[model samples]
Target: MAIDVKPALSPHLVVDDAAAAIDFYVKAFGGVEIGRVPRPDGKLIHAAVEINGAIVMLNDDFPEMTDGKSTTPPALGGTPVTIHLTVTDVDDKFQQAVDAGATVVMPLDDQFWGDRYGMVRDPFGHQWSLGQPVREVSYEEIQQAMSQA
Candidate 1:
């Protein structure tokens, strides 16, 4: 019998400083610390945080995992993935993130697709797209809307 399976893969971000990253995540996105593991040397080996309902895993740079040195993708220039989140109030959440030190990448605005969407870069250097569904559009309506655009 073929079994169907779906595993939720939480994006893992390797930061040069996991402690600061955790604090930044909490402030910038209202993330809550779920757990953390520290090395005997006092370095954070791993940590998990909950943003809304999803879990995000983070850790201090472990060169062994990469090539001998690891750092934020931004420090290396660009990132490979962007984390997106759904919220009830995109505007207020976006502002709260900004007040907590996130850099606004896109101002919150209602889009043609019917979501109040915006983007921000957390102090930890991760990009996040915050969105709130404004209206539910049928597939046919969306197609028509896109065609008109």
Candidate 2:
């Protein structure tokens, strides 16, 4: 089924190759490609994928389309923004992403905030953080943990 909920905020990515990025997202995060609109030159002008109930929009790097303002992460050295995904199985999902050609940026570890979390960078230069809550963590406890850390 297609994404039913319309999120107030959704990430829109400018990638070097929108089609390849969509394929990678599907393999790595079990994303569903909802739609794709291509330019006359055959490059994707707009594409939407749904992952974990959220829509992630993407398009090929068309500098002319944005008055040369928008660029891909590689062109900017690296991305400062990281998409975060909350999953039921962080380890499994993390491994799946890795198996699908994502490079590990951080090893999966249990954090003081009660989550098993890690990060990966996809081949298209997008970074993603995968997290799973392993236990209930109170604000006070988190504060204490932060203080200790």
Candidate 3:
């Protein structure tokens, strides 16, 4: 069965190995594997995982299927996008991801915007940011903090 809720916007990642990425996400972020469709050559054409009540879609990089366009991050020299995950506990989730083979891109700390936030890069070259709300900050407050920084 597919995921129950349809998200208006979901990030679709093209990875070198969809299976491995799925496994890593499950181990690191407590994601639930929704489903996967495999190609004839054993590469995944599509896969979905649910983490923190949201669905993330992924597939194996298939340049041939996309008119030789580079799809994977490494192939493109790196990705410019970072997926932000809002979790209940940023510190715990960040550590869990690190334990599961993710490399820390930033150390988790309470920010002026009132969140404990940090970033990590998955083995597939995808960057993910974990955040937990520590307190509610107004837009003006955030703007002031940004100006000061």
Candidate 4:
């Protein structure tokens, strides 16, 4: 059966370096390099990657696309949304991200939702949430949690 669904939440990051970001993503989250498009000047125009079963697309800083060229993440400070990836062992995954040049935004620990979770920001300034569901929570439990908060 053919399933029609979105593959990834593609986020465009205007980075000072694109190739380094690709390498970092690969080592951090086991991202698979799907494809890359290069411009005539031998610079990456676009690139795609599959990380933890989700597709993430990125490109170099292109002023033509955003009106003005910005080499940093954004003037607004950082990204509004954080990319979450569900893995088997979030602790190990979080460590892997750190080893791959990502900064640990949140230390690995248990959450109120009954999951071992953590967050990291890639070298290019993209934040990621790694988590592993440790136990299943019932609707009542979820309601209680919500009420407590």
Which digits, one per residue and each the tens of the lDDT, describe model 3 over residues 1-149?
A: 88786547888999998999999999999999999999898999999999888889999998988898868888888889999999887888999999999999998999999999999999999999999998999999999999999
Give residue 93's lDDT in candidate 1 (0 to 100): 88
List, residue by residue over 12-130, the lDDT tens digit for candidate 1: 88887898888888887789999999999867988999998888999988778777766777667757677999999788889988998888888899887788999888776788899
- Model 2 per-residue lDDT tens digits across residues 81-119: 999999998888999999999999999999999999999
Model 2 Cα displacement at 75 (Å)? 0.5
Structure candidate 3, residue pairs in collision: none
User: CA lDDT, every prediction?
Assistant: 0.85, 0.94, 0.93, 0.81
Whole-model lDDT for model 1 versus the true structure? 0.85
**Each prediction's RMSD to truth:** 3.8, 3.2, 2.6, 3.3
In angstroms, the error of model 4 at 14 is 3.7
The positional error of residue 128 in candidate 2, measured at the CA in angstroms, is: 0.5
Question: Clashes in each model (backbone N, CA, C under 3 Å)?
Answer: 0, 0, 0, 0
RMSD of 1: 3.8
Estimate the overall C-alpha local distance difference test score of candidate 4: 0.81
Span of 10 residues, lowest total lDDT, candidate 3: 1-10
Task: List the candidate 1 regions with Cα displacement exceeding 4 Å.
Answer: 1-7
List model 4 lDDT by residue over 58-138, tens digit each.
Answer: 888877676675645555478777888999978888999999888888999987788899998888777889999998878
TM-score of each: 0.85, 0.91, 0.91, 0.85
Model 2, residue pairs in steric clash: none
